[model samples]
Target: MKPILLDVPLQLETDRLFLRAPLQAGDGDVVYEAIRDSINELKQWLSLFQTIPTVEETEIILRNAHIDFLKRESFRYLIFHKDTNEFIGTASLHAINWKVSKCEIGYWINTQFSGKGYMTEAVRELINLGFQQLRFRRIGIRCESTNLSSRSIAEKLGFKLEGTLRNDDLSADGSKLTDICIYSIIM
Candidate 1:
């Protein structure tokens, strides 16, 4: 089946959050603000946040993400609070391989929204979407070994620790080598 022809949901909901594709022109403003507020923490794990981006740049990046969504190359869901409608963070099913029926899950939360289990809740929804809705055979989560919080989410969600890659990649800031932890759930 063609990935572009797949009937993927643009939005998903949890008890406290909603995850949606970045489709609106002005959506970047909120996302940019979240990034700005969480830049320090984000920079530790995400190379994209190494430098704060302007609103215009964020908008452009989101536009490209929309294009990717349309092509079904990837899905980037912007997380929001259900009642307050505040942007929490983003969770993505990327590095997809439709033929193999597998993909990787990636996520980050605004510093303000961290430690509330919001990210873990958002990811649980993604896992359901990937397995039950999308019918993926395997879903994987990869994070730097030093990112204990991220590792905890995977562990808490019952994703088995497959292995750890020694000196797998450079840190987000490219300052030094870092180990990569691989976790997965197989359907």
Candidate 2:
């Protein structure tokens, strides 16, 4: 089936959070603020913000993400607190393989929202969406082996650790090589 023909939910509700695709024109600013506030921590893992990005640049990326969502190439959602309507983080069902019904899930939360189990809950919902709603055969998550917090999230969700890719990629600072742990669930 052409993915664009697939019925994708515009929003997903958890107990305290709302997950939705980046469809609003002004949505990028909120995400940019979150990244700005969390850059010290985020830069340790993600190289996407190696340098702080301007609001305009972030908006462009968010706009492109919307296009990708329409094409069903990848699904990037901006997460928000249901009650407060505050942006909490971002997550994506990316690196899709429509034929195999597989996709990789990635996420990052604002530092202030960390340790609250928000991301864990968000990821669980994505897993359900991927397997039951999206009808995917496999869902995988890859993270740096040294990132215990991220690895723990996958374990908590009952995703099995497939293996560690040694020297799989560069460290966040690009100063050295790092190992990556791949975890997956197959339906």
Cα displacement (Å) at residue 31, model 2: 0.9
Off by over 4 Å in 1: none
For residues 2-76, write the lDDT of model 2, one tens digit per residue. Answer: 788999998999999999999998887898999999999899999897888999999999999999999999988
Looking at model 1, which ten-residue stretch has the lowest summed lDDT? Answer: 1-10
lDDT of 2: 0.93
> Least lDDT summed over 10 consecutive residues: which range in candidate 2?
1-10
Per-residue lDDT of candidate 1, residues 4-97 (tens digit): 8989999999999999999988998999999999999999999999999999999999999999999988899999999999999999999999
What C-alpha lDDT do the candidate models reach, one value each? Answer: 0.95, 0.93
Model 1 lDDT at residue 65: 90
Cα miss at 108, model 1 (Å)? 0.7
